[model samples]
Target: MLEATIPVKHKVGLHARPASLFVQTAAKFSSAIKVKNLSANGNFVDAKSIIMVLTLGVMKDHEIVIQTEGADADAALAALKSLIESNFGES
Candidate 1:
């Protein structure tokens, strides 16, 4: 398993569009991806589920822990981390 701790850089946090993008990225991997909102009292949720992700109510600067386990765990974590670090390609 691979894990990464990252901050939500998007100005509006993981709302509809960003959450959709996140779910899409997570689904591309063979790994089982899970996310925990560290800033939200360590609540863990499925990374591939947009509904679950949205339930996190992640806000800007909130820290999240992403974990993946499977054949492509490293690649999956890299892509997801990049997406967040890029602010979901939004300014």
Candidate 2:
């Protein structure tokens, strides 16, 4: 498993649209992806689960914990980090 810390770049955080985009990106990978907030409740959320992400209610500057396990973990992490860094293309 590989893990990384990313801050929410979207002004409104991972809402419906951004969460949907995140789920779509995560689904493209063959690895198992999980997202969490260490500062929140410390529970991991399914990266491809829209409802789970929506429940997080992440906001800008919020730190997100990402984990992936699989052969393509590095690539998956890079792509996911880029996606989040781009504010889900809202930036």
Candidate 3:
């Protein structure tokens, strides 16, 4: 498994459009991906599920840990880390 912690920089965090983009990105990979809201001391949730991700209540400046496993784990981790680091394109 591969994992990384990143802080969300989007003004709205992972809500609405950002959340959708995140889920969409995760869906592109076949690897299993999970995200935990470290800022909220939250549990891991399905990265590919909009509902599960939304439930994370990830606000701006919140730190999240992304974990991925399976054949594309490295790629999946990189993609997700890039997404968040890019502020979900909200910048």
Candidate 4:
């Protein structure tokens, strides 16, 4: 398994369209992806699960823990980190 901690840089945080983009990105990987909000009191959810993501209520500056496992875990994680670093490329 691979893991990393990512910070939300988007002004509106990970919600709505951003979350949808994330979902799409996650689906590209064959590995299992998961996201956990520690600052939100240890709430964790499957990255592919939009409902779980919305439940976390992620906010700007909040920290999310990303983890994955499978054949493409490394590549998937790098891509995911890049996406997070770019704030989902939304304005």
Candidate 5:
């Protein structure tokens, strides 16, 4: 498995449209992706599920740990990391 801790950079965090975009990005990968909100005490959820992701209650500057396993794990992690770092292109 590949993992990375990424900070949420979007002003509104991962909610609504941002969450939707995240789910979409996660789904593009064949790797199993999971996310844990470290700031929320480490509850992990499926990254491809919008409902599961929304439950994280992620907020701006909150740190999240992303894990990817299986084929294309590296690519998936890189893409997701870039998306978050890009602020979901919201700025």
Candidate 6:
């Protein structure tokens, strides 16, 4: 398994559209992905599920730990890291 801690920089964080985008990105990977909101001290949840991701209550500047396992773990981590680092493509 591969894991990385990433900070959410989007204005609204992981909610609504951002959470949807995050779930969408995770769904593209064949690997199993999980996310935990470090700042919130939350437990890990399915990254591919919009509802679970939303439950993390990830607000702006909150740190999250993403774990990926399986054939595409590396790619999955990189993709998710990129998404958060890029602020979910928001300006």
Clashing pairs in 6: none
Over 4 Å off, model 5: none
Each candidate's clash count:
0, 0, 0, 0, 0, 0
RMSD of 2: 1.2
TM-score of each: 0.95, 0.91, 0.96, 0.92, 0.95, 0.96
Worst 10 residues of 3 by lDDT: 82-91
What C-alpha lDDT does candidate 5 achieve relative to the native structure?
0.92
> Candidate 1, which ten residues in sequence have the lowest lDDT sum?
36-45
Residue-level lDDT tens digits of model 4 in 1-91: 9999989887777798888888789999999999998678865688998888888888889889999999999999999899988778754
Better of 1 and 3 by lDDT: 3
Reference-based lDDT, each prediction: 0.91, 0.87, 0.92, 0.86, 0.92, 0.92
Candidate 1, residue 16: Cα displacement in angstroms equals 1.6
User: lDDT tens string, model 2, 41-71?
Assistant: 8589888898888787788789999999998
RMSD of each: 1.0, 1.2, 0.8, 1.2, 0.9, 0.7
Candidate 3 achieves a global lDDT of 0.92
Q: Tens digit of lDDT per residue, candidate 3, span 9-91? A: 89999999999999999999999999999989779999999999999999999999999999999999998889888877756
> What would the TM-score be for candidate 6 when compared with the true structure?
0.96
After aligning candidate 4 to the native by TM-score, how far in Å is the CA of 73 from where it should be? 0.4
Clashes of 2: 0
Query: Which whole-number lDDT from 0 to 100 does residue 63 have in model 3?
Result: 92
- RMSD in angstroms between candidate 6 and the native structure over all alpha carbons: 0.7
Model 2, 38: alpha-carbon shift in Å? 2.6
Per-residue lDDT for 46 in model 6?
96
